[model samples]
Target: MRNFDQWLSEMRPSINEYNFYVNFEKVYANVDSMKVELNILNSLVGSKDIEQDFREILKRYPETLRCIPTLLAVRQHEIYAQDEEGAFLYDFSRMNYSVEQYIAFMKKTGLLSLIGEHIINNLVDYCLGIETGLDSNARKNRGGHQMERLVEVYLKKAGLEYYKEMYLTQIEQTWGVDLSAISAEGTSTKRWDFVVKTDQRIYLIETNFYSSGGSKLNETSRSYKMIAEEAKSIPDTEFVWITDGGGWKSARRNLHETFDVLEHLYNIADLERGIFNSIFV
Candidate 1:
């Protein structure tokens, strides 16, 4: 099998396309939901007592009630079930909350806000073709430069490796760890991302660039759990997951839970400290 670097080089385009498609889906869904919610909120604006109640709730329980799933559900039910809207209005009236606080929370955490900002900036130039656009057939190619620039900026600031050797060299020099890129058959996998050997243990490190979604986390967690269990059978081997890229921002909440279950989960920042400190310190 090809090593991870080669596989990544060959697969980066497809992975990026997947990311954009997923993001677009999320944006469209959120926008549709927002429109419905806005209409419901508009109707409630006429009720002075209920409006005052909502404002109080927003002030008090911003984190719990203002979460994305709850907000989405509230809006969905308000728009679809008119009967429920009366109950919702009654509930809000008792609580003392306001619509403004809800909107503020949406603006704070929603990825749509970021997407909207990007669209506003590039709408006339890229979307409308009012300005020059680069020639590219791939979806990733269209916005790939921006993504690469972001990645490069993050790598420079965070000491993440775009190329594999930088990571391996850091490990070797800082902690006396030697790294090799290996394959599944126990052969030297040149395409492998990282294989590090310390005085007492050998570790197989896989650097995933994919976004961390709930489903993705479940699958990765299962794989890592198996690897961890399997590594125990070997007596002296270890596994480490080194994930990076902006994709992590979206599913960080779910990923955090997944990491908690795994014995060895490290991001680029953790990797920079040298594997010795990462695992031990």
Candidate 2:
């Protein structure tokens, strides 16, 4: 058995890959989808008569209205507000309110000033920048995927055929593992990150990476520990957890508890040492 200190020492400080920060491909796709709408709204830029110009543009291109909230960095089409004047829900989807009401909304919300005063030159370019800013919000999800992608690389390198996001039903039908202990009488919607078949055995894998400490790490540690025990009950099947990141340092006690019972748990450092070769062999 590995000592707690020794196991903690093996935890990685970071598993951040190059694409961990911003998924530019997804950002580009988002921006591309809104390109036509943003271009149509460009008519409002630097318009001395923003109200008249905006109404004219909307008459020709109703879809442009849906792109308005995003100019202010909002993801939704409907904006709600209660001001000194009155309460209103501005639906930019197709201008649910009158043009005058929208003009009032624009002026009150400072969007008219933003465009009429030439604060920005082109809505197309400006929205591209806004879309970039909005894409930053996806960093958390992208960061979470780094560990999965990293594990996939090693899995591929080990030459093991695998399926991603394998469900309990699929595993039962394929291997006949009797997952009743893990699922609710074999009717649960449980799924695993990856499932591999090799040399008369099936491996169930779970993966996660954390860069910051949170209560989630503790919960994840406990939960995966339960999964590890459940997998142990089925013959010819094993559970493998691939987790890393300095965040575990703060939750070492919880991680240590899981580590004590789950020897198949590994980190980035373990992969670097060719652990997959031994395990997958």
Candidate 3:
């Protein structure tokens, strides 16, 4: 049996400087039960005529099961010897691998074609050298940037132009106002996510999409508070916060108290129907 620790030591220098990788190797090496299981898998796969049932094999060789999917995915690209069908088996192998593991495997295999189509297509095109797709990691650094891009496209297709127009057009037609006037000086500190100005008063608008709950929410909240404090400096200016992300279900109440006016999509529709009257009135 290959000493797992020795194998990991040989590969350690090539791995990224992340502690997680080190911890993963340590955990795998120290687990004696897992090591025994791996020996059984090695013996099973070594057989030639023994008809192997994957589930049955998995029962005895559970430790090796984790690597099977990755091996299958690599087979798709024929990184190993070509399968009987001559089709790449890598995809089949990767059925159970995590996204990161799949990506790492692709990188190791130098299968640019498969990587470009499967992983890069979903990540930010910039990171993967693609020209057209949105950066899946751009919005507040969440990993699901591709999913968010899809959502944005869907919202646009659904005739939700008001949301887009709010950012593009500084003027709020219903309220007979333009938010751009609130921070007319346009200092670094005055930059806000959204802003509107009416004949009666100026308003600063801060917008956020909270897909996941963590540092992103805290960072966004901090940004909003900064914008709010900046808006407050202007005597008559009001601060309005507009945020709608799936994570709002968990964070709505906490956020409401932090901002002067907090509105979700439901409130956005109502506010649009009533125009500025719902807010100002």
Winner by TM-score = 2
| Off by more than 4 A, model 3 | 1-190, 222-230, 259-277
**TM-score for every candidate vs. truth?**
0.32, 0.88, 0.32
Residues 38-142 of candidate 1 have per-residue lDDT tens digits of 333332233345435435545654332322333333322222212322332213322233566444444444423432333333211222121112112234543
Candidate 2 residue spans exceeding 4 A from truth: 1-4, 32-40, 84-86
Better of 2 and 3 by lDDT: 2
Predictions: Cα RMSD each: 18.9, 2.4, 20.2
**Model 3: per-residue lDDT, tens digit, 65-179?**
4443332331122244343434333343224444444344444554333333332232222212221112222323433333333334434444332232243133344454434
Q: Going through the candidates in order, what is the number of backbone clashes in each?
A: 16, 0, 18
Q: Global CA lDDT of candidate 3, please?
A: 0.39
lDDT of 2 by residue, 1-281 (tens): 55767756777777766666666787678778888888777767788888889878767787877877987899988999778889999998767888788878878889889988899988877777887888888778777777888899999998888999999999999877788877868778888999988877888899888878999999999998998888788888888998888889999988988988997999888888888888863
Give the candidates in order of lDDT, highest first. 2, 1, 3
Candidates by TM-score, descending order: 2, 3, 1
- Highest lDDT: which candidate? 2
- How far residue 111's Cα lies from its native spot in candidate 1, in Å, is 41
Error (Å) of candidate 2 at residue 1 is 5.6
